[model samples]
Target: MNWQDEAMRYEPLKAQDLYDFATAEQKQEAVEAYNRAVNKLRSGNGDVAGIALRQLAAQYPDFAEAGLLSVCCQMLWGDRRGALQILQRFSQAGYLTEDESFKTERYLAAVSSEPARETEDPGAVVVMDGENLRRDTVKPPRLLRRASADSGVEVASASEQEAFLREHNLNLKKHHYVASRSSNLLIKWLVTLLIILLLIALLLVVFLLLPQGGKTGAAATASPGLLNWSGLRLWRPVNLFQA
Candidate 1:
């Protein structure tokens, strides 16, 4: 049967029910493990805490506290779907119920009240043992300062948070695109200029060589005396007959 069906088959177990089933040594171990996980979570080590909690829940399936705290860690890590699945699993295991206090926890309640959307804001604060444990909010770009969580101040709404992230991403992409296009255009212009300069240099070389060729042709035509000196001279026979 599916988890929902399975969950419906058995009545939910409370903390006392879980304790009743555990051995004395297992109970002591569970309590110690739960405390360590809580300490890790309070110290902002949610990743380690989450793993520990999951292991604790697995080792002692009846430990309701471990399961509930695991949900908290999932929410803290921005894993809403994961958190919900853990709750479902716990429900199926009889450690959680529809009327359990886990549902009323601030993180779950906030996410549950809203429709699932890309823009939904997972809350920045976690409630544990009737205490508000504030998480560090991400700092947005300078342009989105109005929506940022400054000095523990919460954002006005989820919509503003979504807008801030969207605008920041758009601006980053736009900057990269503009920079790339500009570099391409600059390269094209430089190449075109270099080609133009090369052509001009070629024309200048051709022009410079043309004058030297013309001078050589003129010198060859004007030096006919040199060719005549190397051959037979002109004769003066008519002058001898007159004498």
Candidate 2:
């Protein structure tokens, strides 16, 4: 059942709702239920409120207040000792304290004198009482690290743990921004190196494909005076021997 919603809907089931003549016990029980509901809300546990609501409505439908709050405690639970104590007390109580109709002394005397008859259903009879109920609020705790059952890990006690939670509460958990900047720098340097190597490779290919030739602009044409020594007998090839 949606107990948390019900608890909030009828937040303070007034003392008058019980029987018109409100007693201190009735007032206190309403206050107690309201406070515990608030505690369960803060602790983020709806199950506790549900259990309490079921028991309270069953025991004292008129009182609309006192109840038990029990939880398995394996799930996401917080530290709420006051709420737990209220549940424990309800679990072990005798009948409803405010219910003047229930005489506990007479009931116990009858039980002791005679045992249950044959075919009598064997179920626990819940006896509700809230005389010792008190409301207490729980303060929020820090990040709690859970250990793996398979791994070799030692669970730390409350005394062993430090008062302040370390880096777990820090706003910036990692330096991802810095790492990204460094990666960008490495990529830029790699591209620059590749460009330089490509340019060097192009220059080498051009040099290798160039035509090889002997040195030029040094052999001058023979001067006319040097050739004139043989100019006096200059003649056609056919008449050069006779001349």
Candidate 3:
């Protein structure tokens, strides 16, 4: 019989059943089944692993380790969203912790591992392909020279990385108003031109309407002036200009 059938059959058959049943061997068989499922998952046989995981979860709901295994199986089976939902539900049920339910063996292993060692040759230089050196990597000794130059820049110093703002101005962060200034400048020019055009049009109108020196000289000369009116005696008209 299968692991589940064996477990169910032998569960109630205790006491004398312990002696009569294959309980110890059955538990070992169950572990073997679990290991087989885990191996399938590791080997990318996700569908088979997922079935095994589901069966294990159904048989062992209280097993936290099995819960973790089931979730991983779900993830490998391309049911990432399903796995996340299950984790969330388990967390809400107070059966999972912040890190415990979400932790992946891969992530935990990586976190617990040591840093990688650099095996690069110190004498050989590796230059990156680019038009500018600012954005490219240099191999070995050349890199050391560029780094050790009197410029006080260490090649490894992240804070003083030469290429950090190579194409951008650092001060630009503090001058957001520069764009506004440019826009205002353009508007000012437009307004000034409009005012100048208006002034020119007004001048043109005045010039067009006013009589020129010789254009209507005859008519202007014939027109009576205030002095001419003042000089007129009104005694003969009973003092018409007395005021």
| lDDT scores in order | 0.47, 0.35, 0.40
Candidate 3: regions farther than 4 A off: 1-30, 92-243
Write model 2 residue lDDT over 10-51, tens digit each, in one string: 343445444422345644454455455446544554433433
What TM value does model 2 have? 0.22
User: How displaced is residue 5 in candidate 2, in Å?
Assistant: 5.6
Q: Clash pairs of candidate 2? A: none
lDDT (10s digit) by residue, model 3, range 134-230: 3222222222224423453233333222232222221111111112223456699999999999999999988887766456655544554422234
| Candidate achieving higher lDDT, 1 or 3 | 1
Candidate whose TM-score is highest:
1
Which residues of candidate 2, in runs, are more than 4 Å off?
A: 1-22, 64-243
TM-score of structure candidate 1: 0.35
Lowest lDDT sum, 10 consecutive residues, model 2, at: 164-173
The global Cα lDDT (0 to 1) of model 2 is 0.35
Highest-scoring model, lDDT: 1
The all-Cα superposition gives candidate 1 an RMSD in Å to the true structure of 22.4
**Residue pairs in collision within model 1:** none
Q: What ordering of candidates by TM-score runs from best to worst?
A: 1, 3, 2
Score every model by TM-score: 0.35, 0.22, 0.27
TM-score of 3: 0.27
